[model samples]
Target: MATESARSERAGGVSSLRGLAGGGVFLPGDEEYDRARTTWALAVDLRPAAVAFPTSAAEVAAVVRAAASAGLRVAPVGTGHNAHPLGDLTDSVLLRMSGMSRIDIDPDARRARVEAGALWLPVIEAAAAHGLSALHGSSPDTGVVGYSLGGGVGWYGRALGLAANSVTAVELVTADGSLTRVDAEHEPELFWAVRGGGGANFGVVTTIEFTLYPIETAYAGMLVWDLRDAHRVLSRWARWAADAPDAVTTSYRHLQYPPIPEIPEPFRGRQLVIVDGAVLADDAEAERILAPLRDLGPELDTFGRVPAATLARLHMDPEQPTPGGGQSALLDELPPAAVDRLVEVAGADSGSSLFLAAELRQLGGALGRSQPGAGAVARLDGQFQLITGGMMVGEFAKQTVADCERVVDAMAPYSRGRQYLNFQEEAVDPSTGYDASTWDALLRLRKNADPAGLFQANHEIPHR
Candidate 1:
């Protein structure tokens, strides 16, 4: 079905990529091309002309050079966990980093250096092996570089700050196919842009070096309640978390689990309210600190001590692809009145989606402190990030997004006028997601570093 001219153009692009290191390119007609281009977000259907699995940073540079010469857009792909709201690549040269998977933990330095292609699972497992833990996102399946680059916020964010703040160094391949190392001491401008600025705005990160902490165990998990108690639970949770220590982070969701055999009978196909949370720094103090929450009436309680590797199960975010839409806002505060209003909009009584998950992460503590000389990672200081997401398909996608915005707009009173980069579902103007000053600062850095606009992927910060 290809036009002769278009076919010729693609052939030319394919030919130019053939000699680039690690392996040959995956062209459109190739049998494995479709499988290789699939992203974790089921809704994203990528149609890249080619996918290049670079074995090294030099090879990544080579791919960028070839794309530049062929006038093709370049994108970086890691664990493909671009989550809903973040657009995926189309008709671009996907510089898939899967081949670059590598992780090294320096016990003495209490730091870990990982390739851009690696997922957080390996990092958590590796860190746990040494009785240490890295500041990673909720899902262990998320790519470290991809998440950290977007200022990853996890259960420990309040205690440790966004994951990007823990990064010490980055090795990136820029627009001109040149390699550059960024950190507080080197390429300070690019360093600022890469931290929490989102991906594709700067360059393709090859590897990242970040600090890790020593944490052996914590009290974590969730409690499930019937939909009838959703309003009451929401109000109680709002008040309890307001005074919660930085060590604790929690989120509540109004969900209707499908009646599948995989789902427990008690929760199957039933509307329910569940609280998922974690206590990061202390095990003994967790019980006393979280007692107020635990005392709230709930049908089921599953909290207990757990290792970091199994933390992803706490939220139990589906691993497989599902059609969904999501939107997010950074919250300045969450009071009981605000929670009551939120319940009015998306609670069990609302005949919207069968599932609606609203997360509230406690902020302050280390999250409010700036990492000295952290360049870009130091820009984030949001008090709390609120996200409302749902799984919907086909014609309902638009309705879902609209429904989400209603909740977002209704909660504007408590918002910080910022959005979480990861939860964004649409192609948003880069300026709207960050604080005005933060956006301006990122723009200044992008202008100086990735002035050519080469790397563009999830939640992209375009070259100005």
Candidate 2:
């Protein structure tokens, strides 16, 4: 089915796309083009010259070769959660990888092999079936590959560290259009780069293999308080998290539920404060650890033992795709002044219209320490990852962006001036996501592997 790009001598450099055998291609004028280019972030409008869905490795290779041959860059995406930064895809072939969703669990070895498009939900469930679990983030639908590439911080992050470091091997289609397998032994440097340095700078990853843990369950749930109690709750949580034991990981959030029919009546249009996470300890020990927060008397406390798979949906992130934008910053320990600034910006009386005003995920434990043979992101350099954002589809889009920025900027006094790439939506200096030496190594490797600049990543590591 030749469309505008192919018919017009492959304008935008998407020539010879007919070679994609396993999946289909949608050009600029095709009816499916809009739908194909749509990412999980509906707010991000991506009108690339072409969008290709490749089901197998061979097809990915074909698309890569075709785009490179025609002087087009290939931008591979799964759910497109972080697609906002890949602006102006006029000469880019958007290789949508969702068609290649596949998962294979090796219970004996406690490992799983998943395709680029696989979401964290199925992988979480699969691992749980064998009395194991993967370090998946709050949202189940997040693409595993993209999350890991950007340094994944999940409910288990404090204890287990970032998900990228758990990767064992990666199979990708490189610039030369060759299907290459990289691991600690084979293409070690490339393997290191892909795990945390961002794969888009080198190739379109087809599959990823990662190690799983023997976690069948943990003491996990949420503690909720009325919006009026946000200042107290946040202050208490900030102190508790600073020296919180490594056996637990938690996040504090100020959530404003919308008064929409889709939402349940209990929380509809209600503003509240929430602190939730998992505790990797026995019942008595967990109880002892949570005593300080419990003393504050939350309106709701459901922290108890549950099956590991349940942790995937514990955070209650919107299951479906929604139009939203957010801002995040890595922060040092927050003093009383920082807490005051946060309350001033996003609290109940702050005129903030965001659904999720502010979230501070406790970081330390394994996350603060670099392990042997770690990837590009050796360790998260801050004690807490602060994020604030809201839905942006309606007339409040401008307000939402401004409100989010206000919260982040107000807390700048405590910021580490670093980037947690997974939570960063806007264009930031990529080097902020890494240190000095790691950035230079990744750049040199990218130039050698992709001299012609064949691939485009959301947070691109520029070769030139």
Leading candidate by TM-score = 2
- Model 1: pairs clashing at backbone N, Cα or C within 3 Å: 85-424, 85-425, 192-376
Residue-level lDDT of model 2, residues 137-201, one tens digit each, is 99999999999877889888889999999988999999999999999999999988987888888
Candidate 2: give the clashing pairs: none
TM-score of each: 0.91, 0.97
lDDT of each: 0.76, 0.88
RMSD list, candidates in order? 3.0, 2.8
- Candidate 1 RMSD computed on C-alpha atoms after optimal superposition onto the true structure: 3.0
Count clashes in each candidate, considering only residues at least 3 apart in sequence or on different chains.
3, 0
What's the true lDDT of residue 332 in model 1?
78
Candidate 1 lDDT, tens digit per residue, 139-201?
767789888887777778778877887888999888898999988889777777787775467
TM-score of 2: 0.97
